[model samples]
Target: MRIELVKGVNLNIIPSKQFKTTRIFISFIKSIESKKELAERALLANYLEMCSQNYPTQIDIARKLSQMYGASFGSSVDRRGNYQLINFSIDYIESKYLVGNEDLLSGVIEFLKEIIFNPLKVGENKNFDEETFTRQKNNTIT
Candidate 1:
């Protein structure tokens, strides 16, 4: 089932008793005016997924995800006609499948929220982390 969480956002929940994992996807869509903008958007997507304000390094993020029963986090950019879409996805084993009755879903959701809403910034300029941005940009270019 899908529900409107706010004015411009929606939450979709699909339940299946036969599946062992749950997946959540959040996406942002906007028109791409030019190639430069598209490139910047793609780089931004990469940077956001790589690190956030709370998780400042790739290893830190990975370790946190590992502690949460090996949940997976990812982001990507896609083109649909004249628009660009940025998607953030999280997947984790269902609580029923985990040992000791742990609640991995809540932790995964919180981490995803942090990744989307609280990104690593450079000093007081409010810009993305320079090191992270440069790394992602170079990786994207090659």
Candidate 2:
């Protein structure tokens, strides 16, 4: 998928016409929030990148991917101009690569759903995960 910057908005999707690939995609997002807000969001983002019920530990999750050959998955937090974008996405390699005969698309969807719906929350505030929040705050101070 080709990634091109846009003028405004939160998200965008682009497809590859030059490459004859099916069942594949790449996504882009642009976010605008105060650094303070992003700092808060970052912590929650960090914790959610951990163990979930379907896969209890980081190693467990990695093993699942190994079983599936290789499923590209992860999240990234960064700044783009005045925007701080946190893009969570997956790119399916159609029916040609190192994946199950029918598991690629489903796996991508499930991965996204996990992050979107189950991100760790701050104990009392509508902010970030506590451990990440505290750690980030401490790091910033130093």
Candidate 3:
């Protein structure tokens, strides 16, 4: 099922009972512009995946995931024809499978929202955290 949330934004759902996990994907697609822009997108994916204002470090993010029944969230960049896509995905075990029957779907969604929309900023400027920026830049380079 697919629904258009706005003019160009959409929400898609594909349900399956075969797997014990649920996956949510969000993507940003745009026409390929330049090599520099591609590099920036790659760096952005890395930075977004690693940290946020609420989860300040990789360790903090990992701990949160661990608490969420071993769920994992990540981001990546892909090229499709003339378009470049930056994708964010999260996969977690279904709440029904938990021993306590706890529902984690809402929590998972909130966590992703935090990572994507509440990134750690550097001071009052419109820049990503300096330490995280440098680290992700180096990681993307290698």
Candidate 4:
């Protein structure tokens, strides 16, 4: 079932007894202003998907997800006509499939919130982690 939570936001619920995993996707859509903006937005998406204020490194984020039964986290940028979409997604095994009952949904939601709202930053400049930003930028350019 899919419901419109707001004017532009939606909630989708898919209950399946056949599958052992759950998946969540949160996406942002906007018009592309320029080539530079597109590149920057792509880099930003990569940086946020990889690290957050709580999980400041790739290893930290990976370990945290591993603790949650190997949940997968990622982001991607896509072009739809003249618009650009940035999507952040997570897929994880349900608690029913794990050894113990765990609230993986709550943890995943909290981590996603942190990634979207509290990205890893560097000093008072309010910029992303320098090395990460540079690396993502280079990756985007290539």
Candidate 5:
């Protein structure tokens, strides 16, 4: 099923019983107009993957994922022809597989929301946390 979350953004739901794991992928696509934008997108993707407002550090993210049965989450940037796509993905064990009635799917969705919409920022300033941003920038450079 495909849902238009907004004017240009879409949500696709593919239900399958074949696998014991559930994978969620969110992609941001934009027309490639300049090399600078591509570079910025790449850097932003890396930075977002590392930290968020709620998950302030890599360790925090790791602990959260560990709590969710070792769910794996990541982001990637790709270019296809004239368009560039930044994809954030997470794979987790289905709720039915858990021992209790834990709603892992809801937790996963909340985590994704935190990563995408609530990024870590410098205090009272409209900028990314400098340490995280600099690390990501250096990693991208090297």
Candidate 6:
């Protein structure tokens, strides 16, 4: 095959559909020694997506998103194209939709900070939050 490469573009917009922007969505690829570790890692990784220090719990996070004209927020895991992926997404109506969204941009950024920075890990040394980790583990199977 001929050597070829192409550059990709990042697009930003403030359109009618969404005044808020996509926080982040990228895949991760790494080796897992065993099936169990794969399961465990996936669990912890997902829990971070659930909430953050600011949000603290799933329901509180959900409520905030809901207040933003039914904005949607959450995360998911996938194994595809030889990579293990954790995807986080937040969607909210534009500030004009409600006319009082002074923090829409910052809120989106804070949520992204939580997702990429917080990940599933466990132990006494301050890893994943145990309660959230366990809940994610149980829920992942279904």
Q: Please report the candidate that would top TM-score against the real structure.
A: 5
Write down the lDDT of every candidate, Cα atoms only.
Answer: 0.86, 0.53, 0.87, 0.83, 0.89, 0.61
Candidate 1 lDDT over 17-97, as tens digits, reads: 877888888889999999999999998899999999899999999999899888888999999999999999888899887
lDDT of 6 at 107: 62
lDDT of 4: 0.83
- In angstroms, give how far residue 47 of model 5 lies from its true place: 0.6
Candidate 4 per-residue lDDT, tens place, 4-84, comes to 545666647576788788888878898998988888889889989878889999999999989888899899999898899
* Residue 22, candidate 1: alpha-carbon lDDT: 87
Write the number of the candidate with greater TM-score, choosing between 2 and 4: 4
What order do candidates take by TM-score, descending? 5, 1, 3, 4, 6, 2
Model 3, residue 67: what's the lDDT?
97
Model 6: pairs clashing at backbone N, Cα or C within 3 Å: 19-94, 44-120, 121-128
Q: Which structure is stronger by TM-score: 3 or 6?
A: 3
3 or 4, greater by lDDT: 3
Error of 1 at 3 (Å): 7.5
Better of 5 and 6 by TM-score: 5
Local accuracy of candidate 3 as per-residue lDDT tens digits, 85-130: 9999999998789988898877887797788778888677767888
Give all TM-scores, in the order shown: 0.90, 0.56, 0.89, 0.87, 0.91, 0.64
- List candidate 4 segments past 4 Å from native: 1-11
Runs off by more than 4 Å, candidate 2 = 1-33, 98-100, 120-142
Please provide the root mean square deviation of candidate 6 (C-alpha atoms, Å).
7.2
The per-prediction tally of clashing pairs is: 0, 0, 0, 0, 0, 3
